[model samples]
Target: MEDINLDDAIKLIKDDMHSYELLHDKFLSYINRDPDLKNLVHSYKSRFKDLDHLKSKIERKNHEDSMLPEDEQKGPITQDNIQERITDICGIRILHLYIGQFEAIHKALMKYVNSNELALFEPPKAYTWDPEYSKTFEALGVSPKLKESFYTSVHYVFKPRADSNITCEVQVRTLFEEVWGEIDHTFNYPEPSKSKVIQEQLKVLARVVGAGTRLSDSIFELNSLQDAE
Candidate 1:
């Protein structure tokens, strides 16, 4: 594919923006209708990438990849890479009350993908779920002492239907994790804060959030045990 300039790319995205909005609505409807999924989630939120934000992202990726010529770096960027390259143009976030609920919801999503319940545009194998922090969280089993990137969300990519190419990203996180994410995103998103103190404080807060989630899980387990008697 020939390189198309940044203006052309943004135009292409804007032209198809309505379709992405429709896909987001379709996703919301699907999740609302699925009893198991609805039960697992404490809240659901979604957004389409803002045009300016999308432009910034493409420029950032281009710079990171060193794809543009040195002299043309600040010039009109050209690339046919925007469409397939950007995965989260349409995105949804699923917040669960506990960390334990992630696995069940993930499994149900896989089942939906396998059964073609959402009219998948691609095969089930195309979905991505290999975030390092989530793997560490599962491996460490919610221990307070565990130290890894506090980022804790399982992400999946999907299309609203088999015929569309627009991709939506689904992010699943526990309530505690969501709290940390919001604070972090406010001060440290798109780029991390330069303040050493804030960075350290965020790390400490992450540990606290982790501990809180563990306590919540324990309380639920205890209640379940009590009910069994």
Candidate 2:
């Protein structure tokens, strides 16, 4: 409602864990109903569990912090600075099993969320593996030379269709890749000493992961070949 102020909304959300979960589920329900997103996500049942876990973690973190005294709490939400600018405050990431699934999912998602339906979902920023990263593929000796491009994932942002008051981020990636990437992201990979040693180490680890993916693919292919024979 126009009468509702941004500060009140943010206070309710940031100060109360229940309020936050309520809002998150409300949005997730919307996403699940979306034909393209629903199918893509539901294909893997574990994904729903992952989503629930992620949601719970955020809520728990908030609930813990809210116990602190008001004086210790951060700034007010109603500030113009807060209302006008939007950033990566909320996020959801969908991890797939293979690279082939990436583009398929991407296309479907893009088709689902039109330019108009979006009040604020930022234009999809899609990135696949970088050419430099794929160069490591040769070290692992992936015949046919895996493309040099290795991408972490695709990111999408949007305002809730039902309510334009809040924003959310969506991330998509393959399962193996996401697991590996999560390690790096969680630990702050390539450790910032500006040391070649650290960079090389990360590159090597990344290559091993790539090799694992290739090996998995080969086994799958071999099984298919066996079935055909």
Candidate 3:
């Protein structure tokens, strides 16, 4: 896939000549109805708006890899990079504050998308069994397909009815999944014919990491119970 340069990305984001407003409106409207999602964006936008605090948080988490390199950076304020930043004409992130909140947000999103009757791009292998956690998504009425990477997320392709001029991609991911995504972002996708050994290795890693997360959650719960007692 050909990547858009920083300059081109800025032009796309800045040009009133470009129709980003409609895309933004559609996404905002979708999220506005959900109390959980609205609060998430509000919380993030507030905290992330603080440059020093935001920089410190990102630095502490060691997630600065998502930022564009100096050579790849654009603009005076560096305000724009929508293409690379959001991966869509309209980029919106659905954040889950607690790990347990993922399902609620996901269910809300499904309802909103279904109501809007948007078209989606379903990859053949999208599955959503929380391997590390004791609870299977099957019990939650979720059987989302599983993609290969450790970061578990779904990407949907949606286009507007009024104009087919623009296309948007929606990425649904848990917070932990985003970390996994960043770790593997540099890797290239597999060819149609891929090695089973490579695939097996990745799957094994995913399970192990997921189990670790579940254990952490379990321990936290235990501590909470002890405190209560």
User: Which numbered prediction scores highest in lDDT against the true structure?
Assistant: 1
> What is candidate 2's lDDT per residue for 1-229, written digit by digit as tens?
1122444434434544443344456546655686665755633211221322433443443454466787885533333433223333555677655544444566555544554444444555544344643443333232122222233555666554535545656676657667666666654532333656755665566767667766665676677799999
Full-model lDDT for every candidate: 0.70, 0.50, 0.48
Model 2: residue 118 alpha-carbon error in angstroms: 4.6
Error of 3 at 183 (Å): 1.2
**Stretches > 4 Å off in candidate 3:** 1-21, 28-34, 40-91, 97-99, 114-142, 148-151, 159-166, 189-205, 216-229
Kindly indicate the candidate among 2 and 3 with the higher lDDT.
2
Superposition error at 78 for model 1 (Å): 5.3
Per-residue error (Å), model 2, residue 79: 3.5
Return the TM-score for each candidate structure. Answer: 0.78, 0.53, 0.48
* Clash count of each predicted structure: 1, 12, 6
lDDT of 1 by residue, 39-116 (tens): 887898898888887777776766665665676554334546566677688889988887667667767676666676
Worst 10 residues of 3 by lDDT: 43-52
The pairs that clash in candidate 3 are 126-144, 126-145, 126-146, 127-144, 127-145, 127-146
Ranking according to lDDT, highest score first: 1, 2, 3
Model 2 alpha-carbon miss at residue 225, Å: 9.4
Better of 1 and 3 by lDDT: 1
Of 1 and 2, which scores higher on lDDT? 1
Q: Which of candidates 1 and 3 reaches a greater TM-score?
A: 1
